[model samples]
Target: MDPKEIIARRVAKELSDGDLVNLGIGLPTLVANFIDPKIDVYLQSENGLIGLGPIPEKGQEDKNLTNAGGQYVTLKQGGMYFDSATSFGIIRGGHVNVTVLGALEVDSEGSLASWIIPKKLVPGMGGAMDLVVGAKKVIVATTHTNKGNPKIKTQCSLPLTAYKEVDLIVTELAVIEVKEDGLHLIERHPDTTIEEIINQTDAPLKYTNVKPMEVKS
Candidate 1:
């Protein structure tokens, strides 16, 4: 499977039956496509929506409504729309159960840096910082590396969105849990070697409970 799909599928399994989840831009948004149809999770969009449904088929999309990333989406029955202020209030008030966000870098301490590169100009941080601190649980979905450079580092070089706020990290190669003790390696891609994961990650990893990644056929 493609790396982004691998990460998304893995994260999809982490959601509970009734969880309210917010998907950030990029790879994080892909998790919605992988959620099991039987599950009853509610997808929240920071752009002012709750109960977001799957992407509409072509010609069925509502251009007037979009997610925080501006991607067109369908709304599930009973879904509600409101102002952005209300959406953020739900986030800031700790109503969101989990949030999956794309990260440029996540350090050993679970610090996230995904807003900007500084060297290159990008859009300002919209609601990412708010989501990071507001969500009851945070999961970072990202590739292990970018252009062959390690994104899981000992320390983040970019500006941080939140300090040690991430709870879990799902990458193409490994599923890591950020603990008070250290970065714990919980699972790895079946086709990837432990040595390969270690070499590609700049941060030291604890493998006390490591296992092969579980992928449903």
Candidate 2:
């Protein structure tokens, strides 16, 4: 399976039934496509959407219906739209259950730095700060490395979006839980080994009952 798909699939398992999930742009959005149909997971978009469905079929795209990332999406049967204020209210008022976000870098302390790369021009930080602080749980869905460089570091060098706000980190190589002590390696990708994961990650990882992730093809 594709690495991104693997990461998305693993992240999808983190959701529980009746979760009001806010999926960040990029890889995080792919989680919607992998959610179990039997579960009641309502995908939320910071741009004012609830009950978000998977990506629309190529020809069925509705220009007016887009997620926060501007990707065309289909709304579920009971989905509804609202203004940005109400949408943010849902986030800030602690209505969101889980928020899955992608990160440029995450630290051992569970701090997130995903908004900017300093010199590069990029979109301004959207609702990430609010979502991280407000959501009941925050999961970061990102690759373990970037162009051979480990993204999980001892401390984030970039401007942080939230401090010690991340609860979990799901990568193509492993599933890590962020605890008060530090990053915990709970599961490794079936195709990877502990040595490989340790060598690729910059941050130190503690292990307890580590198992292979159950990734579907």
Candidate 3:
């Protein structure tokens, strides 16, 4: 499978039945496509949606419904819609069980830098700050490197979204957990070598109890 799909599939494993999950834009949005049907998790959108489902077929698209990324989506049963104010309240109230988001850079300290690049223009922080802090747990889903530069760094060089707030990180090649001790290597992609991950990571990694990632597809 491709790297993006690999990362998304792995992250889907983290969701639990009946959990309320907030999926950020970009790669994080792909997680909605991989959620198991039997695992009843509510996929929330910052744009006032709850219980989002997989993308609809071309002819089945609904112009009135979309995710925070502005992509058309199907809603699961009991899905509810409200104004943006109510959505922010849900995020700020810590009612979300888990949040999957993408990051441009993440430090060993678990600080995330994603809203801007500074060198290039992009939209300012929307609801990312609130989601990272208010969610019970935050999981970063991103690639291991960007333009040959290691994204997992000793310290984030860009402006941070949250400091020491990330709970887990799932990349194309590894699954890392952020702990008080440091970044812990929990799972490695089957095709990627340990040395490759070591060479591509800027921060010191703890490999205690590390295991090969079990991806069914």
Candidate 4:
């Protein structure tokens, strides 16, 4: 299976019915496609709306409505749009149940560093700082490695979005639970060994009692 698909599936499995979730661009956006149809979850976009649907069929684009990812989406029944200020109020007021954001780096204390690749790769820090801090649960979804190096570190080397806002991280190779004290390596990839996962990470990480994250049989 594709690694991105695995990450998406793993993320989708964590969702509870009736959650008002804000999904960031990129990998966070993919979670919508993987959510079980039987499980009804409300998707909120930072652009001032809630109850977002997945991408529409080709030739059915709705120019007036788009997601934070800039993709056209259908609004589910009862979906509503407000001003951007109100939308941010909902996010900043902590009414959001969960937020799934893509991260460039996450530290032992659950700090996230996502914007800017350095040397001006991107301009401006977006809604990340708010989403990570405002949501009741902040979950980061990203690959374990970036350009063959561990993205989870002892300390973030880049600018931070929020300190200790991340509750958990789902990577291609492991699922890490972040606590106030430190990160707990709660689950590794099905084939991954604890030693292997540790060696790949640049920081010291403690392990939890939970087993690995796997595709349910």
Q: What is the lDDT of candidate 3?
A: 0.91
- lDDT (C-alpha, whole model) for all candidates: 0.91, 0.92, 0.91, 0.86
Span of 10 residues, lowest total lDDT, candidate 4: 208-217
State the lDDT of candidate 1 residue by residue for 98-156, as single tens digits.
99998899999989998988869677889999999999999999999998999999889
Residue pairs in clash, model 2: none
Across 124-195, the per-residue lDDT of candidate 4 in tens digits comes to 677888888899999999988897899999999998888878899898788888887788888888877889
The candidate maximizing lDDT is 2
| Candidate 2 error regions (>4 Å) | none
Off by over 4 Å in 4: none
List, residue by residue over 18-41, the lDDT tens digit for candidate 3: 899998888888887888778789
**Model 2 — TM-score against the truth?**
0.95
Across 9-128, the per-residue lDDT of candidate 2 in tens digits comes to 989988899999999988998888889878899989888899887787889999999999898988999999999999999998899999999999999999999998888846678899
Best by TM-score: 1
**Model 4 vs. true fold: TM:** 0.95
Runs of candidate 3 exceeding 4 Å displacement: none
The residue pairs in collision within model 3 are none
**After superposing candidate 1, which stretches have Cα over 4 Å from the reference?**
none
